[model samples]
Target: MKRVLVADDASFMRQMIRDIIEPEGYEVVGEASDGVEVVEKFQELNPDVVMMDIVMPKRSGIDAVKSIVEKFPGSKVVMCSALGQEALVMEAIQAGAKDFIVKPFKPDSVVSTLGKVLEKDD
Candidate 1:
């Protein structure tokens, strides 16, 4: 199974994502509640993909993505943003995230987007 690192300041969001992806066969290897923890967890867990929230505490997800991509060029990051954060979403893609999902996630879209991110060549 593909391993995933879930990063979100909201515990409820993390739990919801875990619930959605776990049953779809993705192994949620670790979770991080802040941008700093996201990087730390990514290094420690070395997960196949990271589901990162854009508006995180300590550091922004875009910054975390930049750091992670600099350290691990092959890192696959998927940014999670709110409905109106179009600019931030684009910034995240430029920061090396493979894809993104808007907040209040739909299970099917999440799964499909993640699948595409995983399928892309590094």
Candidate 2:
């Protein structure tokens, strides 16, 4: 099973993603409530995928993405974004995120996008 690290400042969002992603044959190895935690948890969990939020506290998701990508060149990060954040979304993609998902997430979109992104190198 694929292990994912879920990161979001919103507790509810984290739970929601966990509830959906875990039962769908993916293992949610760890969670992070902020960008700083993202770095810490990532070092500990070393998850296969990281669902990251852009506007996190302590560190923005963009910076986190850049940092993680620099440290772990093969890491896959999919930014979790809200509607109307086009610029940031593009920035994230440029920063080396494999892809992104809009907020008010749907299970199908999440699963499909992740599948495509994760399978790219395979």
Candidate 3:
């Protein structure tokens, strides 16, 4: 089972991601409500993949991704963004996020994106 760290400010979004991935055989090992917690939890957990929200408070997802990728080049991060945030999404990709999923998320898209990211050699 792949270990995933979910990061989003909304409680419902976190729960929804958990609900979507759990049944697909992914284990949600940790969750973060902001960019700071995202980095902290990432160091502590070192999960296989991180589902990060781009618009997080404090540090922002792009910054957090850069931090994680700078330290751990093998890190796999799939950004979560709202529709119309294409510029931020592009920035996140440039920052080393493996891929992205748009909200409101569809279960298949989430699962497929995770699968694709996990399939690649880090």
Candidate number that wins on lDDT, 2 or 3: 3
Off by over 4 Å in 2: none
In the range 59-118, model 3's lDDT, one tens digit per residue, is 899999999999889899999999999999999999999999999999999999999999
- List, residue by residue over 16-88, the lDDT tens digit for candidate 2: 9988877788898999999999988998899989999999999999999999989889899999999999999
Error of 2 at 9 (Å): 0.5
For all predictions, the C-alpha RMSD in Å is 0.5, 1.0, 0.6
What are the Cα lDDT values of the candidates?
0.96, 0.92, 0.96
Error of 1 at 49 (Å): 0.1
Q: Please, what's the RMSD in Å of model 2?
A: 1.0
| lDDT agreement of model 2 with the native | 0.92
Residue 122 Cα positional deviation in candidate 3, in Å, after optimal superposition: 2.3
Supply the TM-score for candidate 3. 0.98
